[model samples]
Target: MSTTRTHPVAGRATEVPPRSRTSPPSRRRSSRTRDRLAAAAFLTPLLAYLALFYAFPLFRNLDLSVRGYTVRNFVQGGAPFIGFDNYVKVFTSQTFVPALTHTAVFTLVSIAFQFAVGLALAVFFHSSFRLSATLRALFLVPWLLPLIVSASTWSWMLNSDSGVVNSLLRAVGVDPVNWLTDPNMALVSVLVANIWIGIPFNLVILYSGLQNIPKDLYEAAALDGATAWQTFWRVTFPLLRPVSAIVILLGLVYTLKVFDIIWIMTRGGPAGSSTTLATWTYQLGFGSLLPNFGPAAAVGNILIVLALLAGLAYIRLQRRQEA
Candidate 1:
């Protein structure tokens, strides 16, 4: 071959160019950027909504708590910037302490009953039985019903006169106690109504969790000579832990803020015995035939702090589990 010898450039003569480390890494970086942008685009509306509605109102409420103006006008005495006087009142007021105690007892009892009953129902519906689909839909009806209507219906049912509960009690040869009127019974009445309302929600969530469980896990457990209880505790319960956490957290939050049922059922009545933080706040600030905003704001502020703490705890727990 007739040779064409072109001399290499001076600096490059003895050394070849190192490979450029840019294109693939640059493409990967661009891909990641696009993914993050896509994710942010999806999240934009939710963030905007929270900022506008929840965050703004929360700050406004915090502002109301510290504003020293409301005390300038209490009828019994002037509202003072007693810095946290409102909170102090919430703890010490005869009504507040008992009401809080009642709320704690009510929430614990009702949640336990609802969870047990709901879990049973979920098991019932998890089977491939006739009307399973129809039954699942039926179970959620209580959840779908309007709150006021449910409360009203429950009130009517528990009425001392002309109500189903009383009629049944009479049939059982027990006196038709003042289910809603008696101070001893009113909180229980409220608890009953709450349980009725809460059951459907628990059923839905637990049932959904049951459905998400893999069939193969159960099959494997069975093949290992495991009893049903063993399989459930070892496999099913472990799998259900995340969903159960969600259910418990939400149940506490909802139960703590519960108002409509108690409000309609008892109106915080029979001596303000059945009041919760939410209802007490309403009574203090706005539930009066004439409203007082300062203490009400204070009560509301306490609830906000508690709920915020609960939410933060949940977030931390979730992060720890994820990590």
Candidate 2:
């Protein structure tokens, strides 16, 4: 005899179907597929963008760096495969070492001063005061101005004889200084301009970081009889570190590929005193009377490698810090 099951509905007796063991697994499988499809749908645009913009350019540059590509070859779209020859040429070039040296100096000095001044300003502006808002807004002038415009303005202002700076110095009974004309000072001048431009960016970022710190921490430090300096060193410094790391890493990357300021201000002038890797690459590719695209691409690849290493270091450091 077959058994029947009664469901509580109007006192009715109904037969129920047996449950299948395969149903749960099949449902889970369908759910997982739906999740995967959703994830892919969300990721598709970003992946497409990376492939088109970043991956494509990187591979193209790598290809160009390996081959004997030149302006003629660029027009003709054909070059002989000459592996590592271009890199050898770039390494052997007379300007490479000096350009590398200048790049290091510029990046280091600019980062130091920019961070110091920016941190000081950030700390100061973190307090509420009259005209503080206006001052902060005005401080963004250098950051907001176009690179070409800033370069031109500074170039004119640093003029040996006719500049306002020289005029002010003369008024103060000081002799005129050669800002951009002298090779010794051209790099210094460029560094100053870059530092000025970078300061506001650092200030904004650091200030935001400062604002994010809890007031309770500061109060607790005060309760522990910590003076302002001690509090900063003990509490503020440690907390600010992550932001500082991010800022410095970003500054390093931006400074590494700096091209506009040097290009506009001096054109690597006073005998290439201000030329960095970026300018050197530009010089090789287009600034030269005869463009050597292969060596230029090789130099660019070198820069890309350095940047990639920096990014990797940052990632590792961040992960360690999080841990």
Candidate 3:
């Protein structure tokens, strides 16, 4: 009788509204939103840094490219609005074509030498041999060495006289050649140094790629009566496709932009034979008496365009790999 006196809603267990079931989903959405906000906050500094350092400098360089009616005056900070004259100077100058050709040659030769040496080193170190790890660690030391020290060492070794390399050559009854003095050989000498520096990096990256390959693939191939060469070609090569593309592309871009080795070894010397586009730009921008900044900036812009193209290509390759 007392229960019957209660309201219908109070008498029955209260039926929760169907919308209440969505509360947990709302909370989860809020959590996801908070996480996204936190991630954006974390990324803000990096974005800001790129905008400030990279974007700002690029614009400033471009501004310099279009300014100053004559190359003679920017050295003194006078005049403005020159149109494309400086760019034309860079394109029409005698040094420009040779610098372009030399840079292209340097990139090709260095990439080839680096790939060959690095592949050999990577394969050698990949073997299950004692001291392999230690040798790898030693190899990386060259890359880890300070750039100035590396360049200085090469400069001394390639010195015409009183250098150990020349002394060794002389002792072997070979002529003591002017490694840096001969314009023909100066670029080659710089290439040698750069190749030495590059080999370790290629070795590291390629070795990592080789390691990531499942051993089972080799084993399965072996069971199928496949030769080691066949296994590498079929299984290893296919597996390493992505890594190989990355190595080649990155190497191309890096070798194309090389400046330090040329700078420190020969200082783009021996009648400017060793001067690549980058070194030539440096010469025009700051090294020469006239200091043609606008033309130098134009050359720099060309390099940046190449770098951007390489970057975009890499991105496409990576996307394809991921897909």
TM-score of each: 0.81, 0.91, 0.86
**Cα error, candidate 3, residue 44 (Å):** 1.6
Candidate that would win on TM-score? 2
Q: Given candidate 1, what's the lDDT at residue 166?
A: 85
Q: Rank by lDDT, highest first.
A: 2, 3, 1
242-266 in candidate 1: lDDT tens per residue?
8877887788778888988999999
lDDT of 1 at 252: 79
Q: Candidate 2, residues 113-226: lDDT per residue as tens digits?
A: 999999999999998999999999999999999989998888888889888889999999998999887899999999998999999999999999999999999999999999
Give the Cα error of residue 270 in candidate 2, in Å. 0.9
Q: Is candidate 1 or candidate 2 better by TM-score?
A: 2
Colliding pairs, model 1: 71-79
User: lDDT per residue, candidate 3, 216-279, as tens digits?
Assistant: 9888999999997898789977887888788989899888888888898998888988999999
The local distance difference test score of each candidate is 0.82, 0.92, 0.86
